[model samples]
Target: MAMAFQSILPTLPCFLPASNLPDGIDAPAVARGFATLGAWSLDDFTSDAMWRDSVALTGTLRTFYSAATVSAGWTERCFARQVHAFQLNPDAARVVRPAPGLGWINIPFTFATNTPTTTCSGFVSLVRGEGGWKIWLLRTILEQFDGYPNVDEPPQQPPVPIDGAEYECVIVGCGQSGLSVAGRLQALGVSYVVVDKVSQVGESWLQRYESMKLHTPRETSHLPFGRTFTDEYPEFLSRQDLARGYQAWAEKYSINILFSTELVSGSWNGDRRRWTLHLRQNGEVRSIACTHVVMAVGAGGHEPVRPHYLGEDIFQGDILHTAQYNNPHQWRGKRAIIIGCANSAHDVAEDMVEAGLASVTMVQRSRTCVIPVEYMPTRAADTITTADRNQYSAPLALNWQLSRLHIRAQIEANPARFDALERAGFRVDRSGDVFAHVHERYGGHYLDVGNCANIVKGLIQIKSTSPNHPIRFTPSGLLFSEGSNDSHLPADVIVFATGFKQNVRDTVRQLFGEDVYDAVDDYWGIDNEGEIRGAFKPSYHGNIWFLSGTSGHSRYFSRFIALLIKAGVEGVEVPVYRGVPGKAHEVEEVGGRGRGRGHKN
Candidate 1:
């Protein structure tokens, strides 16, 4: 009868350790039986049978004896002893199947070993052995084991589309001001689109001469939302770094940009209450409709102005403008002459000199201001705390006051601090000094002393004409007047650093028809012939606004304009300025609030 039971025992359902079972079984009664005994322990005799049944079952073994020790040979002896006891009895009878009335029946079993009688606590199942019930299977349930439930993860949401339908605003430039306006609009949760004629953001700077870098430090050059690279690189960012930083910022914020899209025309549709944009993109014409349009096309996007000089066409040697000066390698080892003494002219001259050019002559029609990248007090090594550094470096009126104090102290100690050429063997033509010359030209109305200082220090040479004779062009390589008897000086190259002209009114007129100028004039309350805020006044309609070309020239001024635009959009009180013609302009103390004016250039 026992032999009949043994043959059928292997077919009976036995509850082994829960760990031994396949996953996803929800049988609670079988699970409870596995939890009661330590069937998962390595000492359990039935563990070997369970491993034999499920070949996937594996356990980690630790050998305590070192390789050099004599006991290392006996390590396997201990393992063999355990294996022999398990093989002799196998403890296969302890595995059990639960009855309906009894919770769990523990049928004790003994290991069939000749060495000694070793008993282990386990459970046994009963099988119909031909005529009567007989012990069939045995297993020790692992009492302390627990099973974790599985959870299904939720699905992911799809991405939001770029250049989506129904844009609230459309800004037409990717330069500093355009970026600022786009960022502000984004912060307000307003849908907006930015379009640029160039293929990449900040290409305007990339197209400039190799020597060009930001005049302002990164702390002041940062756009809206406090996005800047100054925190990472304390030094001034080169042109390429600046361009890449702008591109990274646009990507980080996911700013919608339509590259290589030229704005052909845009008109205010009063009936639809939206502006219709006619643009040319990749040889295809597309029109977009938006409630507001911001024209931030900036001052330098159009073709450069090449003045019709008398001998310009006749000169056989290379003659390029500052805008076209890409690299100095072509002019290396040659006598390069750069015309005009503005920032570009100075920069080009320095670059040519550094690139192994034989001689770099700067032909100056007038002097230029060359201020240091940062004033001494604003430098990182100036020994100021981090909090005070930002405050002192800010573009606020109070910050300017601190800067002026520092400048005054330096200038008073040595007036020559403002004149570098005079110290470098070049005579200063001080008919009235640089400050007097500036006061005579623009009057006190718009003169910035720092700009005046830069102009004086950058003047390397002053052209002088002899009495009764036309100014001579010297053969010794110097620029002289047309009437001079001296021979024309030969130059390898000539570059013009004449400043940029801010002329967005013509562009606006061409796009929106003649009505835009009149509308803008009336909106700013400008008299028919009068200029507002040093240029054509800005006009704001609802949350939409336009900052004309004059405002785009200076970086400091553009930042102030951005702030005004933000305040206007947020329904905050507009800042007002009040001052007479000659004195420094002061903001009115109305409600103890005033808007900062753009920097005087």
Candidate 2:
């Protein structure tokens, strides 16, 4: 395996600790093999027979060895071209056996060209077969970025932007989605600029509610190319921590960004195979052209959903969307009603109750899939000896299966949690796949921190609402139908935490024209293959891409996204493989490891 990798990557020497070698393997013979391979490059072994004897391709492992669209070992070839040098730390090498014949090997490596070296770890799973131990899965996690900056220190000089420069790619938004793509682009040596309507790097996160903190642990939230939140940061990152982290990341990478810049309009030039964009930055209109445009704006778009009630006009209270909400201190003595029951609504309700509000009520419209905060993800990188990180490399179907089993186990072990919420008049949805509720539906769930207990203890009131009878606003508050009886809930403020309901298509139409909008596919939601639709992968309109979701999604998928864009930029012909259902052989065409391309775009 080391010789195979060294064939293409001269700078990266894959080291296997002599103590950790398989039972039958001879260390001296391995040393001899490496000594003889000094004269040969990857090109010398061109035939299929060279790799056929040693390598067995299967399942998700194909992603590491080859891609359906590109040639065999395309990923490694690209990585070799991008990275300068790699130094392996043999001390960190270890292997674990979950069962007989199954072994997982982890090795830590570093990039040596930066002021502070970048650390990364690679995982490889092997199965002892009739022939010998063959690699089943190979994965890597970039644990830290090269030359990570210290945000606590006095601000350093920002990178100077080139006047009227043309970029190969123009990324919109500077949040996780945008920065993740930018990090990959920087690694690939792609000329790009990130544009945000906000004034600073972390303004998007900073503008969120002051009381907000991520429910998921800090381990699962690192940006792409391996930049992590420091040890001093909270386990669950606060809004301020995330904000400062984003700012520091941009500085660490010297990412070129234009603040207070809005894209006025955009049009694709099919003739020239590029995009022409009109951007307004600080009152000046600038026109630029690019080979690609990335809409990393986010899933919850700029438009906030504010549902209007019958008598909202006459109501003598503030009707605001959660987007306008800040700390709950202002509403300390007032009665408050929050209109949704997902993560944001739960958070707002908890805040109001904690702030000593006279009345804090959550108006739930639909059944929500609620889980204990303890069940949420912690970083897999935290454990090196365990096979925990392999879960990150699982395919969509496999992940769905694992999630279903895990949720089932959780429900069986803690039935009281769900029962308590149900008895309290909260609709706890126990059916359907949790992954679908998150990745497909986008928001039908909430990871309970303290809100579940608040609901159970009646500190936070739950009023169920339905579309059958619309809510009506009164001079004092809202009128709802409670099991065939009408109930009046008095409130001074109604916060619509109904989420960003605006369709992505509308946002696309508003930015680009109808033609471009029509050309693009519907964004978000999982497709037939269980992979996210119209994102990371190629879109209907070849040069346009959509990136959404949390930091983990961005970190994992950014590699493939960058690879696709890089192929286009370098004029490498990579075909698109659409899989056929129920036919394993036909589907394998989509997962083929062949060495040639038919057409691109």
Candidate 3:
């Protein structure tokens, strides 16, 4: 059915008039507009008149109402740069028509002077309407540093800190979330440092199992303003490959990262409006002070939420969390039962089967939403590809709606894949709401790469457990229920793939005190206005902020987080705009713009 539908796509009527085309557009006007873009200085962004004339007002009229807020975010990243000289080579410009009236243009440009020379080998997007050709979107990134491409390097050693030091901001992790916001701060010339307990930038990934690879494609996994991978790199990167990339990004950009350091505690100073942080560096205590603090520790804190069962002390052969599992080779020929059927559990089961385990069984406690790896952004059908989806322009609610429709169609066209899983007693949520699964629960789903095939082949067994009749530990295995008919599954080893605690606010409370924990909102969920809860925006505490998510999210929203911190440091008033309840079309400003934070690279 999908093939037949594709065959007739070219013959479908678009119903667009001839006027809504580039052929009817004024070529000279388009050229003149780009020339103006090349001539403008950094100061032009601050002028309201220039912004009004150059930018299309597509927020309330055409696309999502949040378009205005995104525009403001762009300004925060592009504003107040100390540029000695700027160059835009229009002769090298390339324009391609995406839709009837929309044009995507890429012009290689350079910013030289205030810092090391930087360049962006990309283009700006424009739309033609009654208002004429105007700048629809401008994506500027730090593509090349010092006229050379960013390259990967071995981990760089961190500098020892003074007994007491001062900085404008202090980020509390060195993973994707930490590096992302730190890179943005570096671009904005903010004084900051990234502190992590690990000794290296990508140590987090390196410590995971050897077979672990990214679910998302390489194009979507890049950090903000970081370099793209060459043909030598695979579409999906392994743990080692990603760790090398992170090390190189940090070294090339001169990101100040202090290794072997852990954040002990933080106390907010009300009168001074700064945070006094206590840190431990390789067993030595050090102190630092900063006006802004970012808990980039991640949406999942370091503390693992371990499950307890009765009689564990007697029955345990070997039990561990997924975080501690390395390779299945150690458990070769041993019976293994993995609890929780999330991504980690499925991946581990597949590994165990390949390693020739005596038996592999996954205990499912609840329903799981599953989708094939190909349905990801880079490999999806053309109608739902990354080119067709503009996360910045479209609202989250609209995106979710479109995603649901596309996913349902894809599954409908290939029913046998899921049908087989259901036949094997594996409960699958066919109506997979990927966004909700990610933002709300963070788990209860797995992107099928090779696990479903193993499950269907009977190499990996399934044991469905009910929450009402909880399972308990037996001497040799697990007891499904208390009744006489309850089944007992024997296992030589047990691996709990159960997920971590969902709320990072609790982690914040543990370090920053009880008042901060109560004052901050819940992290990592969709709020009323469709914005990510407690991220990239000011918390109720005023000076505290949080940043975490996937690489794509980190690349995009890091700028917003930095912008808020930059504004607060500079004493600028930020007015937050929110939609009116029950009035879908109505939007009003409600103190969103805070004084600190900067933009993405």
lDDT of the candidates, in the order given: 0.42, 0.61, 0.63
Error of 3 at 590 (Å): 7.3
Q: What's the true lDDT of residue 139 in model 1?
A: 31
lDDT of 1 by residue, 1-601 (tens): 0010011112222232222322343334333343322222222223112110000000101111111221221222223213122222223223322222222222432222111111212333333323323222233211110121110111122122445545667788887667766655554444678888889988977888776775445554555444357577645567887788788767766677889999898777655666788889999988888766677765323545543344555555677777788878887877766655444666676677568776665554433333333433443432222222223222122222334445445545655644555454323332212222111121111112132342345423333222211232233333345543443556676665544434455566678776554343221111211122222113423323454332122222333333333333334443221222122343131210222222221
Give a tens-digit lDDT track for model 2, residues 1-601. Answer: 0000001111111222122346765433332222211122333221211111000111112222211222234333223224335444444445643334434443333332121133344433333333433343344443333343321122244433445567788989898888877777776666788898999988888888888999888777777544458788988899999988888887887888879999988887777877889999879998998888888887647678666778988889888888898878887899999888889998899889889999888887777778777864344454321323455444444455456556666677888989999899898877435566667666657888888999899998887765333469999998876667778889999998877853465677788877677666677665443455566666546677778787777766665565556556766433343423223355422211122222221
How far out, in Å, is residue 216 in model 2? 0.5
So what's the TM-score on candidate 1? 0.54
Instruction: Write candidate 3's Cα lDDT for 1-601 as tens digits.
Output: 0010011111211121123444554543455466554343333221111121011111111112223443444343234223434466665555645334434443444553222233332244444444444444343332323432132222233322334388889999999989988877666555788999999989999999878998777777777653445456788888998898888888877788889999999888767878899999878987899988888877867666667888888885899898898999988998999988878899899899999999999987777888887875443332222322235333455445455556766887899999999888787878757766776566667888889999898998988774334467888998877456778889989998887777788788788887667667788766544545776566656677788877766765666566556555655444443333224366443332233332211
Model 3 misplacement above 4 A? 1-164, 379-389, 466-469, 482-484, 577-601
Clash count, predicted structure 3? 22
Which window of ten consecutive residues has the lowest lDDT sum in model 3? 1-10
State which candidate, 1 or 2, has the greater TM-score. 2
- Each candidate's TM vs. the true structure? 0.54, 0.72, 0.72
| Model 1 ranges off by over 4 Å | 1-166, 299-303, 374-405, 417-420, 423-479, 482-487, 521-544, 547-601
